[model samples]
Target: MTNLSGLQASRPPEAVYIHIPFCTNKCFYCDFNSYVLKDQPVMDYLRALEQEMELTVRDNPPGVIRSIFVGGGTPTVLKPEEMEYFLKTVRTYFPNWAEDIEFSMEANPGTTDPDKLAVMKAGGVNRVSFGVQAFQNELLSGIGRIHNTDDVYRSLDNARAAGLTNLSIDLMFGLPNQTVDMLGESIKRALALGLPHYSIYSLKVEENTLFHTLFNKNQLPLPTEEDELAMYLLLMSSMEEAGYGQYEISNFAKPGMESRHNITYWRNQDYYGLGAGAHGYARRMRHINVKGVSPYIEATKNGLPRLNAYPVTQEEAMEDFMMVGLRMREGVTGEAFRKQFGRQLEDVFGRPLQKMLSAGLLEHEGGNYRLSRQGILFGNDVFGEFVGVLTEI
Candidate 1:
């Protein structure tokens, strides 16, 4: 495989990230490049996505894909027939899938119907992640979610009836007007579902979103830092008590139910990023697609719909390797760093590594460096220590 710059790839990307940037309505907290799916050019966008896939594989042919993650505004928003066509395009271009390939799709609870779930299952989507932000209906409405608690249960029921057992749900903390007890209740209900996987995150107020506007006006009643920390701690303990492993910072799973596609990102491996506002990395190069829907469609017809493309310098790649790899429980290995950069990890990052080790923020054992139990709470700081250190080396 080769990059767009005509350089041979060290290894072909085995993971894929396809974005579908249409939703029923924009969540107040979301800043992702997505539009409300009201009278949009749905079919035309699907064609453009297919074209991107065709052009992408032609330029940099993929190896046997082990994971394909379709994320979105909401991939499940598509009608049943539309979904059939979209999945068909995927099979046509990237057909060499591993027998145990993890084909996952992100869905909103209200968007999934039995017919749509059937089409998704037939299309090879074995894993489905629903955004179930909270169990309380008032909390869900305050966050601008279209679905209520009933939709969450109904969607899971439909997915199960369709014989899709590899299911996951997402939850959020630090929300507006949320209490510690509220979060504890949400976690309790979530555990009761007995799903294989859960992804819980804190709300971050980013620009260009309604939440940001409310925050700037001091109208958003977010939890205090102390409360937020308590919420996080509670979740970790609750998931552990329920026999779910906290595999990543914000993710938990039963054995073997962890998200492999996300591991690709945590390990800083290459993957094909298709559709509007997508980002792809391959052969030390990174590319970001145009964010707007119409602009992406127009650009893909003529050529690749890239907004920006750049090469990653060795220094930056090494920094990225440490930053992303350490997010995993297994952490980064000296062998992987040496293999990729042809230099000892200790030599390149000794200063930062020693500092973190001294501070009890990192633990090194058997040639692997992982965050200490204390460091997991302050992960951002631990990861920040590695940034720009490679450039000095």
Candidate 2:
């Protein structure tokens, strides 16, 4: 196994991300590092993951992990016994978990059971995010999701029954043949559930997914740009009416319910990523693990697979900070920016900041820079400016 004692002694990681890459079936629009189970080596993969953690974490004993996110294939896909073993391995390596660590796991509607959820809770998972893409059965089927609306309800009920109160639901818009009315219905249903947090994302046709193939063949039916924009607006207004705050561009949550683990990423903080296909940023260096299970397992036997690793230049880090920070409603704290990079935020990005301000896309309030409502609508364009600035600098 890889030895991590040196790395751990150098710098302890504040967060950990573990990727579980086995799914019952692949979704049509998904391009994440996951596979449809057709006699996959589940046991072997878990064993390798445990071994990787033992080696990698030896160097960075995870002194006080602030957050731990277990994302898919589908983390809940593992049997209860398997999950116990997986969690046991994690605890064994990361001996020091933060007192208020935000441990989250992604759950599929159909795959989770109360028993498994209880095991996760006992294992220190406090948050559960359900992939409830839509409330309609037809849309679920169209997207190649194995679970139906009933599955969503049942899963939510089970999570609550299992004493999981800090929950989040993921929703999607801009689906094929989706109308504003249908979108409204979905939003209403979601709000009616009184979930603490929600992530509503507009569908993007990514490469290598079923949707992309259909799009290439001119067979995809998607909402018009204007319609999609309308859907977004409706969602925002509906969420506000239902007393949820729009914290991030695509995320809404009640006060104090924002995802701490995700905010760590947006804030550009250091985190450790484990398992196949996981990416991490720590001590100015960024790294990604090997993608495939067998490849990852073999590589980690020697050390962290680390297909790629690079240091983040100060200029690059600043640009990334600005781009990611602007996604939040509260925006980037000018003081935090200055403190982290040892430069005045405005002085560094003076010209572009002024231009964006003049264009009514950005504003400064309480020593922070944030996107205006219009900027939120055209956020991609605003973020593009930072990318251009980064390239030039």
Candidate 3:
């Protein structure tokens, strides 16, 4: 295998991610680049998005798109007509989609209606992930989620009715004032839904969020570290017993229902990111677009709307390959590392490998390195061992 170049890729990107930054309201825990949809320039932003897409494909033409994930504050907030135009714009540029393309959109529970879903299905969207964070109404309200449990049922029903049955929902644990029993109840209800995919994430009180403010004031009521660990263990066992495989750290899915777009990311492949505050990686270069909606719109009028763009260093790419690849239950492989960098995995990360393997945190079988049962609980620690370990390629 030849050494990979920062300016070249084995193939063009086959995955796409488009952001929609408007939401009905901001959640207390969300720090993503999003805004409340009040009087914002909706149509103008869509046009700007279209312009960005046009410029993006011109620079790095896509091959056959296998997956398209539309994420955001709430992508389903768009009116039916707006959604039609947005999806049409997407098809206009990268029209060569795989026959089995996984087109997914993120929707808030109450925001998706039958008409909007019909538009989505007609426009080639086959998957919908709803943000049903919790089943308890009080827990939902405390987390600043406007939708209730009833809304979750109705939203799933609507999606199924619209022929978009490949549905997924998100649930959260380690939330403020939440208990083990509460999380268990939520999981029970979620499993009852019989959805093919579920993403259960722990709360990480990130900076600039309301949770962070409360944490600083010592007013936030969060579960203890022990309880959080317990919650994780419980969910893992629960999902496994219910027939969902833990494909990734935070995601579980039935056979063949894993998120292909997300796997494109976890496997450290390239993808196109469009819309305000989007991030893209292609040909070993990474770029982040302007965060503000108005600024992104104006920036797109001129060019690709990037706030910053730079080639990823060879050493950095190797580090990323280890860090992200280890996040999956499948772990990293020596063959993949060699194919990407033309170097054996041990030659690049020998020290970290010996350390983690000695510590019984990583298990090696054949050519692959995966997290052991114990390593699964301390994944971040194992991943940290790979960063900054390479000083030269």
Candidate 4:
């Protein structure tokens, strides 16, 4: 067994994440690097992304790409022609899309129409995840979402017409002025969609967002801890009852419909991160690109627009493995950890293991350590005990 830092790999990555930084509008709670689409150099940025793909593949070639996730402010904001051009660039540079590749794109409800969806499908996007945060129009408006419930239905119909059956929708709970009954109604509506997957996330007030401003000003009316917990429990129970498995902390899917691209991330494997403000992990190194639109486009003409790039130390890698791996309902496997790091899991983080197991927050069975039902709520606390225990913070 070896430490996590400098863990060697036998092949290149099979996953690619392309970022499209343009959005119609910024959501109140979003902190993801994105910009308004108006008057932006959309074509110029696409060209830069093409160049980046060429250079990145030349530097470190890819294997058969099993998954490609194009995420952004809203990937569907691209006009049909623009999307065609962008997808062509991807297909040209990364020629080896696996026969069963799961190509996914994030789209807002109003952004995706039949024409744009056709371009996406032709361009290799087989999965569409709509940003339908809530079904209630008032909550949608309060949260800065432009689309109403009608747009949600229209977008789903458009996606179906485009022949994308492997669909997923994103929902949010614990929103401002939202109630338990409101969340339940939203969940009921979402389940009626009969989609294969759903991503339900709780609201987090990150820095530099409108929500943060409201929180700082004491104007935000977030749900109490009890209510938030209740929301989580209700969603979990509802999804399972509806025949979806809670594969990850924030994601649920039908049988064999889990997000492979996301799993590559939780497994701490390598993947290419393309576009402005995108992050990548490869060859024991992690890198983030320049965040600004103009800066990223200009910097790419010279070379890759990397804001920060560094090889992860062994201890840090171990910590990352535990942190992300535990986010899954499957938890971390002792066997897989040994195969990856060449050491026993307990040999590295035995101290935290003893504490979590003793506290009944983590459980071990069949060579895996996963969160118990009680442990799921205290996941952060369990993960924290692993952090800074092996390396300097």
Work out the TM-score per prediction: 0.97, 0.96, 0.98, 0.97
lDDT measured at residue 267 in model 2 versus the true structure, 0 to 100: 90
What stretches of model 2 exceed 4 Å from their correct place? 1-11, 390-393
lDDT of 3 by residue, 1-393 (tens): 123574347589999999999999989999999999999999999999999999988988889999999999899999999999999999999899999999999999999999999999999999999999999999999988999999999999999998899999999999999999999999999999999999999999999999899999999999999999999999999999999999999999999999999999998999999999999998888999999999999999899999999888878888999999998999999998988888889988988999999999999999999999899999999999988887633
TM-score of 1: 0.97
The predicted structure with the larger TM-score, 2 or 4, is 4
> Which residue pairs collide, candidate 2?
4-58, 4-59, 5-58, 5-59, 7-59, 8-59, 8-60
lDDT leaderboard ranking = 3, 1, 4, 2
Cα RMSD for predicted model 1: 2.3
The parts of candidate 1 lying over 4 Å away from their true place are 1-8
Q: Across residues 181-283, which tens digit of lDDT does each residue of candidate 1 receive?
A: 9999999998999999999999999999999999999999999999999999999999999999998889999999999999999988889999999999998
Evaluated against the true structure, the overall lDDT of model 1 is 0.92
C-alpha lDDT values of all predictions: 0.92, 0.88, 0.93, 0.91
The top-ranked prediction according to lDDT is 3
